[model samples]
Target: MALGWKLVVDAGDPHRQAAFWAEALGYQIEDNSTLIERLLAAGTVEQSLCVEFQGRLFWRDAAAVRHPDDPFDPVSGTGLGRRLLFNRVPEPKAGKNRLHVDVHADRGQRDATVARLRAHGATLVRHVKEPGGEWSVLTDPEGNEFCVS
Candidate 1:
């Protein structure tokens, strides 16, 4: 049998990271507020565990984004398919990411993609041109490194 998984990333601000990745990947931010409201109303979850952003409630320390076409639990808005979860951490990113996402672009779209990402708060670390091909290395707003090729 095979196992399923979701990628999890540590962040200083999970909500912000969710928004960034959602836009970057054309994904939707998961909306778990319906379940949260029910839990809060039933006194199953404390108010302190939730935070309101843009008038929507979310788990205080975590947020997630999901592929738009993926199946998900409607009531909880939890993705059942490909997803990325971001959780808050007290410490900042210390070094390079051991695993990083690579954004693939069409054959000639690399520069335009890099420019768009830069406008969206990605910092260009450098451009690499090896025997394989070229790619632009970038760091997300919170300093997690990724690449565009």
Candidate 2:
């Protein structure tokens, strides 16, 4: 059987990170409110760990986005494929990312994609060009590095 996984990122503001990544990747934000409500009602989870977002309860320390067409659990709102999870951290991001995501745009659309991402709060870091390829390095709203190619 194939192993399943989701990319996780650390962020100071997990919900904002989820929102930006969802828009960037054409993904849907996972609700998870039903599960949270159930946990709260049963006293299985602390009420302090939840917050209302868009009038729905969400875990205060994490948020996620999943591919629109991916299969997800309706009860927990967790995606079964192509997902990214952002978890809250007390400290701000520092130094470079050991692993970073690369956003591959449709042919010849990299620059346009980068521009759109910038408009959505990404910071243009620098452009790279080598014999092998070219791409733009950018930082997300929370300063995590990613590339557009």
Candidate 3:
């Protein structure tokens, strides 16, 4: 059997990170209302356990997005592949990201990708070019660096 993994980000505001990353990756936010409602009806979760995000009920402090065709568990709304999971952390992001994602656009679409990423709140930190190829290093609003090539 194949195994799946989620790239979990520790952030002061997990929902905000999820929102940013969802747009950055063109992924859909996972909706967990069914489970939330079930838990509330069963008295397992408090009435205040669910929070409204963008006018929709969602579990506070955590959210995820996945590839459009990926499988998800109906009960928990957990994704099975190409997932990014954002969880709450008390501390703010500082320094540099030792591990970051690299996105590859079409052969000649790097510049367009950079523009789109910047529109999504990423800033171009630097650009690199060589005999081999070219790429742009960018940082998200929270200062996490990623590469586009």
Q: Kindly report which residue pairs in candidate 3 clash with one another.
A: none
Model 3: per-residue Cα lDDT at residue 10: 82
27 in model 1: Cα distance from truth in Å? 0.8
TM-score of each candidate structure, all chains considered together? 0.95, 0.94, 0.90
Could you tell me how far off, in angstroms, the CA of residue 2 lies in candidate 1 after the best superposition? 2.3
Model 3 per-residue lDDT tens digits across residues 44-117: 98876567887677777788888778888888787877899888778888888889999888899999999998
Q: After superposition, how far is residue 60 of candidate 1 from its true place, in Å?
A: 0.5
Displacement of the residue 126 alpha carbon in candidate 2, Å: 0.8
- Screening candidate 1 with a backbone cut-off below 3 angstroms (N, C-alpha, C), the clashing residue pairs are none
Scored by CA lDDT, what does every candidate get? Answer: 0.93, 0.94, 0.83
Return whichever of 2 and 3 wins on lDDT: 2
Cα lDDT tens digits for candidate 2, 5-119: 9999989999989989998988999999999999999999999999887678889999999999989999899999999999998998889899999999999999999999999
Indicate the TM-score of model 2: 0.94
lDDT of 1 by residue, 25-126 (tens): 889999999999999999999999999975899999999999999999998999999999999999999977999999997889899988988888889999
Candidate 1: lDDT over CA atoms?
0.93
